[model samples]
Target: MLNLTLSTSSYFILGSYVHIGSLKYLYFMLTAMLYIVIFIVNISLIVVICMNRSLHEPMYLFLCSLFVNELYGSTGLFPFLLVQILSDIHTVSAPLCFLQIFCVYTYVNIEICNLAVMSYDRYLAIYCPLQYNTLMTFNKAVIFIAVIWFYSFVKFLITLSLNIRLTFCGNVINSVICHNYLVVKLACSDTRVNNIYGLFGTVLSILVPLLPIIFSYMEIFKVCFSGCKQTRQKAVSTCTPHLASLLNFSFGCCFEIIQSRFDMTSVPRLLRIILSLYFAIIQPLLNPIMFGLQMSKIRNTCKRVFCYKMLTRHKDTM
Candidate 1:
């Protein structure tokens, strides 16, 4: 039996990396390009929302929070990925690994909470249009955003504290990134506390956001079915991108959870790697593109901003 206990100076070996030899360069370039695109698109949308007074509504404010999170989550993963792809060894220090775990867990929590809040905002807009302004004021929206972020951080800070107390029997993590569950599994010390809290945390994470999301959508559907054609169209247009994003993120997260908790040695290694990366990479890229194209207000504002920049550049050249 492996009896080594993890210490502050210890490092973890990431065991999922396949040595692709010269192909590592190709992988590195693609990852770098993907990271760059995710950064630019998410940042552009955030800038647009912040600069436009017309977009100061609750929906846009929620969206700005979402985009900022995309940047936060992507930054946590992509830089580490880029370095690992180019390096000969696949290891990360204990502190860095735990930091990644904190970033990732908090990002997921904030994302689901943000989406749930957005759904409630949509519900107010559609169901109680008369009172929407008063019900979801700018101040209220700001407070919701603040609470979602703050709550997620505190919740995961406790989780990290629990995991930090564990003395690991092994220092090898079977995934490309530092995963909390996988790290806990390596503990030589008693992890009953960690496991119990983990189960409670998971339930809270899903239920807190999920219950509101379900209620909001149920109310929305009720209004849509009985209301005018305009009401149905409004719901369809606004909810489609959100629904798509939610489903996409959910699927990615589900696959990751399943992969982490179960034995999946039968699955192809390449496919496993891709699926593991889906949530972090695809969701961030997808949210900006989907929201940018589907929302007319954002689209038109982007066009105006682009045209103004071009016109100013042309005058400077002249």
Candidate 2:
């Protein structure tokens, strides 16, 4: 057993791996492909939204923000994860591990809050069409985006500070991803303070944005049912994408929370790896596909962007 306290720069063993001794290259290739696809899709959506003037609306702006957040979240994990997969030893430096914890959690918090903001945007568009423009102006959209990131960092910083104070006895992180809660468990000291703060932080993070999302969706549904067919169609077209993204992310978050908090040691190590990676790998890929398929404006814009790129490539070749 390695004594973590004696050396501040000790590494942590990432203890999640499946038996694939000969298939390491294959594993690396598949993982790299997924990460690359995630990057391309999210970046494409962001570019399509930003380059088109028609997509400058509040709803699209929020989508762009979500894409950016997804990119932020994915970059935090995939780069490090991809590198780790190629190496024989699965270890992360102490500083790098903590940094990953911050980046991953902050991404999650911002994601939920961004979804809440999108829900609110939908509520305003359907419930108060007249005020929607005034309420969700471009400047306000920017501010909301800023708040989503700022608030997430501020709240998580408290938990991270508490975590920094705890002294660790062990350095083995029993999962693929570096989670703050799991890191807290490695500490040798009394973790009551860390646990209390963690619980408070977790609840605060979830409830603050989650309640607003539920309320906004409730109001949106009420309006959709009572309003005209056109209104109903508009509501469905716009809100469905956000709702799908929310449900997908919510399930992933719930699974992660359950896995992290409870004892699931009997579960197969492969299953555990999948559970840990689902949110990090899946949600980022899903968001663009959901929006691209569901939102006509985005779909149309993407088509145009692709066509333009193809034309340019042909011209260059000729």
Candidate 3:
């Protein structure tokens, strides 16, 4: 029988009390709150997009998709982590391990495609405003969303099948959640096939999505200056948030692809934590904030959310 022993040390790879002292606990706690805030905000945005007729445009639709992606990203990583923070038994079953890693990857891949698709939507709106309606019709947007899900699911099945064939031999995982790279690293059997797939998957997830974003913005810039000054301001505000998000998201993919080679270095532990926080944690949190800041429509919708809730509460008293 596979020994399934669990421990506080085994699961919470970065423990609150681990030689780092109480600060680690505070670190994990604050980030956990960020995850919760992000989840709620994104879900709320999704509802607004669905209910508000004015938001039925291609851009808002794409924004809603991104909000959903952020929601999933936060959900996949944080709840298990929150439980680990508060509970004594912090380990996950090997099967559950597979599932957690799988979901994280699936959503992440979907988000990459969604960003690319969003960039295309922007390209159509800005690059060919007259044809934007015919170019990115609602049906095309729906099909694009479906393709994102399907593509990611296929990759998940491929990676999962290849990973399941390996032998764990022991039950210890160093990460708080089931991290895919870390898991494959622990496999006792040959994982060259899995590693190759990992490499390909990384390129698809990062570079494939990256190309259109760069190209789209390049075109956007060309056309922006050719129009009114108002167009230039709108272009900068809109593109800035998306650019920040794409860069931050790419940081994880870049790190993961090369992480195995770097773990042995004399790099300080603090730097690793900062990178993980910025790439994995803060990036998702930043998306909703970026949308709220740059997109006046989303910001107004968010404000209406609070006012709507308060009005309902007042009516209940009456």
Candidate 4:
């Protein structure tokens, strides 16, 4: 379950063993289907945003970026895991393994910054609605997003460079995804500096985004609660999803980073498996649903996209 914790040794979940049983096979099929469904939904969102002028605002632009991020982020690991789980061979080469690590970590780091930036944008929109359009201009948003990608690239490069200095004499990783802590642990060299920097990095990455989210909601609550009945209802309806996502995603990060420093052997492997699935897979999958499902326009756009082809086919048959 927690076998993904190893770093330096090549491993295969032998078919004769726990890796390829009936239950595991079912899990693979389900995960693949889930990934396909979510990817399609995110793609539909991209198409809708691209074609619709009404969604040309900064908020919608941010949403489009999010759809792309999730699509790529999930794409990097999900399919590979699916194939590995199904195939007899579970081993990956050194270069491909490193690349997979880079892709998964980089996109996730970008997502962290994007969420923070989006939260800031929301703060301005709700807290300073009259000046939001001027403050979060189209050009400014474009710059912010560009910076996000640049920052992610630089961060991953630094982290990967540090890891590469150490030799992986053995080829072992315990999880489906090459988890960050496992990578650090697998390094044949000392990771003292890396460990210290990692601590600071974790705090900065999690807290920087979360602090603003906390304050943003504080202000939102103050403003929304102070309003009259109808206004309060309207504000609550709008803010609920953002607040829930902020809490859930922030909690996932905290648990992942903070607890990873402890001894893995002490914890039950089943528990660790639960945590990994929750933090890595489920949290990213939920973001679009949490934010986008509430929007009437997006749902309608999705319905039209799906039905358009079917309707045309039916008309031709008639």
Winner by lDDT: 1
What is the per-residue lDDT of model 1 for residues 1-318, given as tens digits with 9 covering 90 to 100?
Answer: 322234533789999998899999999999999999999999999999999999999899999999999999999999999999998899998878988999999999999999999999999999999999999999999999999999999998888788777787788899999999999988888899999999999999999999999999999999999999999999999999999999999999998998888898999998998898789999999999999999999999999999999999999999
lDDT of each: 0.93, 0.84, 0.73, 0.70
After superposition, the stretches of candidate 4 with alpha carbons farther than 4 Å from their true spots are 1-17, 254-271, 304-310
What is the lDDT, from 0 to 100, of the residue 309 in candidate 2?
A: 90
- Which prediction has more favorable lDDT, 3 or 4? 3
**Model 2: lDDT to the true structure:** 0.84
- Poorest lDDT segment (10 consecutive residues) of candidate 2: 1-10
C-alpha RMSD of each candidate structure in angstroms: 2.9, 3.0, 4.2, 4.9
Question: Which residue ranges in model 3 land beyond 4 Å of their true spot?
Answer: 1-31, 87-90, 169-174, 255-260, 268-271, 311-318
Q: What is the lDDT of candidate 4?
A: 0.70
As for lDDT, the candidate ahead, 1 or 2, is: 1
lDDT of 2 by residue, 1-318 (tens): 333244343678888755577688888898889989989999989888888998898888888988998899989988887788777888888767877888999999999988998898889988999987888899999899888889999877776667666777888887887888778878888889888878888788878888989899899889888999999999888888788889999889878878877888898777877886788889999999999899888898778888999999999999
Model 1 lDDT at residue 162: 82
Give per-candidate clash totals: 0, 0, 0, 13
Residue runs of model 1 more than 4 Å from their true location after superposition: 1-9
Q: After superposing candidate 2 on the true structure, give the runs of residues whose Cα lies further than 4 Å from its correct spot.
A: 1-9, 315-318
Q: Best to worst by lDDT, what's the order?
A: 1, 2, 3, 4
Candidate 1 vs. truth: CA RMSD?
2.9
Candidate 3, residues 1-318, lDDT tens digits: the string is 333332112331322213444565786688677877887777877888898888888788778878887777777777766666565555666666777777888878887788898887788877887898999988888888888888898989788777766765455554445777877776677889999999998878877777988899889989887988887876787778888887778776566445434552465555543554354567677887787778888778778888999999999999
